[model samples]
Target: MDPKTASNLSFILNKPHDVEFKSRDLPTLSDPHDVLVAINYTGICGSDVHYWTHGAIGHYVVKEPMVLGHESAGTIVEVGSAVTTLRPGDRVALEPGYPCRRCGPCLSGKYNLCPEMRFAATPPYHGTLTGFWVSPADFCYKLPESVTLQEGALVEPLAVAVHIVRQAVVTPGQSVVVMGAGPVGLLCAAVARAFGASTVVSVDIVESKLAFAKSFCSTHTYSSQRIPAPENASNIRALAPNLAGGADVVIDASGAEPSIQTSLHVVRTGGTYVQGGMGRDEITFPIMAMCLKEVTAKGSFRYGSGDYKLAVELVASGRVDVRKLISGVVDFEDAEQAFEKVKEGEVIKILIAGPNEKKE
Candidate 1:
């Protein structure tokens, strides 16, 4: 390829803690239903930083240089011949993952479980932290007039929370307890409230995060204690006694073993438990207690089916405001600094500006 033929500038992760800016060849529509987007903003996810510093996530290893972002929004500069919902100059959020539509899970509307899913920023798949990207037109959600591209980039995490809340089956007049105060956790609490949960409690080990949660979405916050898991569960129940036995739904977004243990114990008998955080591959589970209480335990992966679309509607309607979760934004050239800040635990959700636009 000639040097002049390349115009897609991207931040490539060459190895652990090593990233370089390079102009990749402009991406093309791989299928008749695909669309090309000019990336405008990209958010830093924990998984993104992990890949940048570890060169791999689980079995997904970086054997070659790969682009470095997935949470993103961009302008659709070109659409495939079969695409109809989008056209040139449309602003939309990139879902960043596409599964094989030929699988049983895909047919069942659970494509997130498809074994052949090609997720961006994972091994061998280029991410969206670039000037241009290509994705299926169906995965690209157009931003309404009420939403901004900065907010559009947040649809990914919001979709994760939506899926978690959906798995938990959160309902009106119920109490929901969310473990962890990160972006996803906070969003989970918010979505639960939007789903009609009467009381939302956010639990975290950090007092500051809990404070932020109280102001952001949760009706209450619990700072973890050094006591036993059962006692912690009891104390959490004391914070919100609206539910009889305990919280109607318990979600673990922290992935910490202690949180997991307490989350299982915190759910009322016959209540639901959803694991949404990324922890170790294995942990000491309280299977017996869960069995005795008849707790329904479910694992939440990435968003699925109507998750992204619902997330967009939630944000657009102001039911779940993600703007408060944004800690800061950095320019595209300083994308490395954004990664460093997140690695150092200095920011919540920081976005990197694309070359096509300045700070929004």
Candidate 2:
């Protein structure tokens, strides 16, 4: 297959806010286990915005023109010879990353940590933010009839939340605090509740986002901007009286240093603390306090095996309402506006459609 033969409408990041829609040749499946999909909807992610603005995320730099977007859902248009689980016309969510299955991490069922992961829209890999894309059949989960393509696109982010909740081992009657009311944070709160957490508190700087968090599944919402930061432990206790009383688990989805610091201060002794968001490579952690409380702190990257499947189940079983999180949908041509909305932090999730988009 020649690179010139692929047909795609890519949002090329030439400059900030400058998106180019190019028509290239269609992509072909190289491996017998691969499948070709006609993408219908792609969700604008924060990482996509980061790449658009800074042109780099951590060590992954966009040195050349690259397609943006990873959260996507589509219908199978073709399948390779060895693929038996999926067929043409199957509606599915494309798990954007494909890891080296022969690696140690893959054998240990932690493929998300595989060092040779080819994640879409991340760098050196084209993304699914186009009309058609190719991926391994195993990475694509078939969506149930009840789930729409939009909901299928949401499965990508929901999978991250699912993985975090599983890592935290959230159980019934446990009190959970989610610092950050972004899309992932809201999804985490919803999944935690589905996993039987008795109480879920979402803290964010935006009151509107906090209000939106309540609509999904959070038991309580707090605006940290409204509550000034404390100068000492006494002030911290006063600010988060309910949480200072002790939380069984704290998930930092904001990636902000302050939120990470407060998570340690508010979590109960022996509680679990999980970092679900990415921020600076290094920060001043409360190591002494974490040690004193015997808190278990862990970092959650992208979703691992079975996370995407569970994410689809959560939506299909009506356990999590993903539609409420969708702020707006834009045509494929207006995809740039979707990114702008995300930059403005005015929407929870934005869905971009293809040329043949059908109303749902």
Candidate 3:
């Protein structure tokens, strides 16, 4: 261990809307396959905000003083005896979820669904907001010289987009409409284009968000506030006649009830619809239209096998650029303030430097 590594400082959430900086024990490599990392950058995710403001997401509740953050990148500070793929000083993007390799889902190569999976920032599991995080060597991906630490932190979310696109089997010469102009939505659009979608339309209530989406990879932008939910599909079709025939797929990143309903009306017959966003646990669906159109609706979770690797390839190959989506990068002391901006919809993606505070 480095001589500077004594104790660790972390941002902890005592409860809903209550955050504090606390001294934490320096993590040691307990398993031979584990690698201890000095966290360099951690992105503020929407789920983190949901936990901060609501104290829980679904069954996961923050009853204890849990550390908050998951999208993170760092350098290996120490490696266990059995680890060989990475060593100290190696830059890496830490994959936050690691499942028991003996589980049914693991055997089936869908480890993201493993029942015994433990994910960072989830209740009862401390996250990567601290100075040092210990993760499995296999789960920590080495970053190439071309990818920055900021881009590395973003790979987590980008992996989510990759999984969603893969689920839908996005293909060439197809028209895709993505609802919501949030960070994930924008990335989804970018990935859709990288996946060979002919036309990509982004829908949002905010013009600034739509503009941001267009600036990235959205071929067309629509303001949902101006168009009523009932007329969204029609207006989008009229605006882009090539898309008038109906979108080949619709990915809802907004998770709004209206967007969910609009998806049902807009997708072409036998089209695919993937829910990339999370909103109400239960919402009304246009089952009749769905059944009649034979639209295949699928829900996407975090990420699974081969997703993270592909995300890194997308960045390394220069096929998908994530830096444009970064709105700000703040110091560890200002993390709470950054989360406040997320709550107010003031920023797209903000990365908080680790407690050690190193710039790359």
Candidate 4:
């Protein structure tokens, strides 16, 4: 077969908020297990903004003009010979990571930790922020009729929240405190409620974001900036008495130092605390408080094996109203402005339509 040549428009990151529309060759399926998708919508993520501004996130650096989106949904236009689960015309959410199935982590069902994982929008690996993207068939989950392409695009981040909830092992009648009202934090609160948490508190410095959280899932909202920094656990207990009074779990989606510190202080002894966001690689944590409380701390990476499936199910069943989180939709030409909105912390989730004529 001859090599298929096609043009795809992508958001290229040259610097912070320095995104430009560029034409690139459409990617091809290198293996029989691959599938090609015509992207419909992609969401602006925090990591994408970090890469645009800093050119790197931790060890992953953008050495070339890399496409800048991972959370996406699209229609399958082509399928490889070995692919049987998905077919042409199927609308699906693209799971951005493709791991080497032979790796220890992958074989153990923890593919998110696979050392040889090739994830989109993560330096070196081109992302799905384009007119067309090609991915492994197994990673493209079919969307049900109830799920819209916009909601499908949001499943990626929702899966992250699901994974955090799973890691925390939240149970019914428990209380959860999510430290961030960003997309992930809001989703975490939503997922926590869906998972049967009796009370979920979402905290953030932004009052508008907190209000948004309340509208979606949070039972309680706190503007952390308004509260004085706790000098110790007792101080935190006083400030957040209701939440600190024996909360079962605390999820830190903010990735901020103060949030992390407060999570440890607010969680009851022997309760779980999961770090769902990536902030500085290292931060000054209150180790003494964590040890004294015997807090169980875990760092959550991206979604693992069952997370994407659960996220899709949540959207399909209407358990998670992902569409409510979408703040605005922009055309592919205005994709840069979408990223700017996220950078300015002005939007919750901005969905960028693929390269197509604008709908009337």
Angstrom error of the Cα, residue 272, model 1: value is: 0.2
What are the clashing pairs of model 2?
5-25, 5-26, 6-24, 6-25, 6-26, 7-24, 7-25, 7-26
Error of 1 at 183 (Å): 0.5
Candidate 1 TM-score, true structure as reference: 0.97
Question: What overall lDDT goes with each candidate model?
Answer: 0.91, 0.86, 0.90, 0.86
Q: Which stretches of candidate 4 lie over 4 Å from their true place?
A: 1-7, 15-17, 226-244
lDDT of 4 by residue, 1-360 (tens): 111443487888866556788888867788999998988899999888888888998888888878889999998888999999998889999999999999889889999999988999887888888878889898999999989999999999999999999999999888888988899999999999999998888888888998989899988787775353454334434544455565789899988888888788778888999999888878997788689889999989999988999999998998899999899999888887887899998889999998752454
Better of 1 and 4 by lDDT: 1
Model 2 C-alpha lDDT per residue in residues 49-130, reported as the tens digit of each score: 9988888888988877888889999988889999999998899999999999999999999999999999999888888778
Local accuracy of candidate 3 as per-residue lDDT tens digits, 36-138: 8988899998999999999899999998999999999998988899998998889999899989999888999999999888999998999999989999999
TM-scores, one per candidate? 0.97, 0.93, 0.97, 0.94
Candidate 1: C-alpha RMSD after superposition? 2.2
Best by lDDT: 1
List candidate 1 segments past 4 Å from native: 1-7
In model 4, pairs of residues that clash are none
What are the root-mean-square deviations of the candidates from the true structure over C-alphas? 2.2, 3.0, 1.5, 2.6
The TM-score, computed over Cα atoms with residue i paired to residue i, of candidate 4 is 0.94
Query: Which is the better candidate, 1 or 4, if ranked by TM-score?
Result: 1
* Model 2 TM: 0.93
User: Of the candidates numbered 3 and 4, which has the greater lDDT value?
Assistant: 3
